[model samples]
Target: MAAFTASVIPIVSFILITLAVRCHATALIEGLYCGKKNCYDVLGINRDSDKQDIAKSYRRLARKYHPDVSKESDPEEKFREVANAYEILKDDESRRDYDYMLDHPEEFYGHYYRYYRRRMSPQVDVRVVIAGVITFVSIFQYMHGWWRYNDAMKYLLNEPKYRTMAVSKANELGLLSKIERRKRPKEDVKADEEAVLRKMLEENVDVRGGYSRPSLWDVMWVRVVLLPYTLVLYVIWWFKWQWTYFVMKQEYTEEDRHYLTRKALKLTTVQWESIGREKQSELIEKELWVNDNFQAYTNQQQEEMKAKYAESAKYRRYRRYMKNHKPGPIVDSD
Candidate 1:
């Protein structure tokens, strides 16, 4: 049984790695792009079309080929495509990628897949890894810290109020430092003292996604003390193992591709409108009637929004925690 468990993991990891490669990192782009050459390609606009001309062309085509009024054999299909095209040409990132593709048109299908993720992803991944490491190390450190806290805890334990107060202080310091998020619902935020604190503590509960163990424990067998170390080592192994597996199993299905294409198109439209607005804004600020700021501002806003959303998962978790935890503790001096 020990042999089986020992053999299973690496074997599974190997298989997962193979699968990741097969999937072609679909997470990067499986559902994050439109295939049209550019926003212009989507709307059937010519390369020579100016900004106004492009807009005019889009409006005209959108109206003439609208799915609602058109009765051609593939009218709806054609109209949808037209709409999809227009939407993409109108957005910033989609349009930019489309433009980049135009310039780097030689990029093979494989290279094109990278469009699914941004360069900042690596930084984010590193941050998360660092956070996990910090959490694990601190946990073990506290385990060792246990010896020192023995006396302090005994003193504080006699005063239930102090113990409770200490927990509250830990909770608050944890929050103020932004160590983690509150785990309460918005409705529960307004609740009484105990209820709120309880909710907040709930958020800090470590949510491990699979049967992931620690990383510090990776070592040759026969040592009981190494078992705990195995947990830490397991963490590091699991992460690399998971990454390798994911990379091996990366794949994008037809439907996933379709979703990405549609989303990219819509994003493109929003980007274009944003670009136009920034240009107009720039023109406003300038004594001269120039719209040079159009591109810069559009790019800036898209970047900002993308960044905000990129870290949104963490933000939401923290917000929930804050809303749940009560501010202070109730102490009874007996």
Candidate 2:
């Protein structure tokens, strides 16, 4: 009875394995470009044929069926069939998949996956694509930065405040002579004036934050190229931070204090700069660089905001509405 049971188990396992193989093969055959015809039969090659043998056979078949060269009645269709067979068998990976499909002709999904994967796979090298993308992004970023800088310059040129200052500076430098202005065409005179204003802005004005001059280092390609150096610097900074804050427990430096103050105010460098130098000086004068002072300042501001909100009619109306209305699901009626 024990022997019989063991024999029966082996037979059951064999039958299950055979069924799985058949299912896999069926799936692959369904996805073949040549329909139900075997690729090996199409290529006139045996199942055990090597790459060289397959290539040789393909060459002969291709030449015989080629529409341009062959005298065959259905040369186009015959050439296509030959090309399709060669395409499947040319690559080692694809050939292996084809061989698997032939061996296990029952798996429907596996064949579809194999077909789609081959069809969808990129022909270009991934690294080349990545490099092209980085280059494009860097160029775009650099161009965009310059565009914004130009817009800011245009604004400054148009504004009376800055325009008057620039005109004065140009006059002091003797760039806008009355004689030259009179002799030249009005268009030329206007151009010269614009040039002078641009020069004055470039020399005197210190543009900061987003409107600041674009640098190669800010572009994606440059950043990617310098990533290793940046990583090294980051590691050193981490070590220094650990030593300063944990090991030494030292007080913050002037730069550190400024950074912390900016963080406390929840301001980006651009936003902080937009506050103007006078406002910045006022904040610094209040000793906000000190952690305790910063905390107290924040608390005071929060309390002031709360008092203002309580007094506001808009806030009162919003609060009253929310309190009076209880959220509930909407009922549908026919």
Candidate 3:
């Protein structure tokens, strides 16, 4: 019983180790549904806040929480978060993406896919373990294949059919005396082809009686190594594509569209200024823009209106409500 228990322990340990590795790989691939950390709250600002306000908030937080300046336990972490939030809010395109993510939190699959695409990589430890495991296993498999090939050749030389062929090759290769002529039953004539090749190996000749042994490339190199590695990598890409499909298939609600439109309207100062006056008027007439800058007819008045809309009570109320509201788990449409 003790012997049996000892023998089973390693098998159980091996299975557990495999499960841990697979779970880690799957976690890296599937990623997490985003948590409800409001970026606006992180910066102590509202969504309607303009670039200047964002810059000001970021500078204040950086001064307060910088690891060098603050004695807080997680000053560096808070500093990093503040910096990230500022970077997003400072740019029009990135801010829009963030707004979209907040509005449609159920659509996190796409964001996670993009995040893992950029971030997920085999760490040094994982790579080292995988390399060591594959190397040892592959060497064992190769040696086993080599031994089996030799055993098969010895088996073949004893067969009546191969005895004549192998003996002739042995004589020609000056190994006839070294060859052990075995007279086994005729039933053993049906030996594996690899065993026939072994007779040539014994003769010290490169060719297996004029037929060559398969090169490493032609035989088990990929089967023992490349195939498993390729399968693991393919899992990541497969899960990514599956999640992308899930994200795209989700229907956009009216509220989602509204928030997206509002985000689109909040163009960067540079973006708004670069547009022609006629095009700006065209946008205003379409009612797609709600920026206070575009509320004015002239560029001079619009420039004065910058950063003022973000301070309004009504906009702040709306922004506050959106930040506080949390969506539930996403339901599968299918």
Top candidate, metric lDDT:
2
List runs of model 2 lying over 4 Å from the truth: 1-28, 33-36, 45-56, 67-77, 102-108, 121-132, 177-183, 273-295, 303-334
Better of 2 and 3 by TM-score: 2
1-334 per-residue lDDT for model 2 (tens digits)? 9999999999999999998866654643544756677788899998889989999999999999988899999999989888999898888888888787666665657777887888899988899999999989989999999999999999999999999999899889887774366566899878877988888988898888888889887899988989999999999998998899779999777667656667768899788778887777677666775688988888998999999999999999999998999677888976
Order of all candidates by lDDT, from best down to worst?
A: 2, 3, 1
Best TM-score among the predictions, by candidate number:
2
lDDT of 2 at 295: 84
TM-score of each: 0.25, 0.70, 0.25
RMSD to native for every prediction? 36.3, 6.7, 39.5
Candidate 3 minimal-lDDT segment of 10 residues: 26-35
Total clashing residue pairs per candidate? Answer: 49, 13, 2
For residues 1-334, could you state the per-residue lDDT of candidate 1 as single tens digits? Answer: 9999999999999999987665433322323344432346566676566567767887887777777876667777767667766665665555666556554544547335645554234635686786677677666654554544444434444566654664576567664344223886755443334343433443443222221222334222223446677788989977865665466665544444433333433445334344465553443443221234545645777999988976899887877887897567878988
lDDT of 3 by residue, 240-289 (tens): 65665466666434444443344557764445545666665555454443
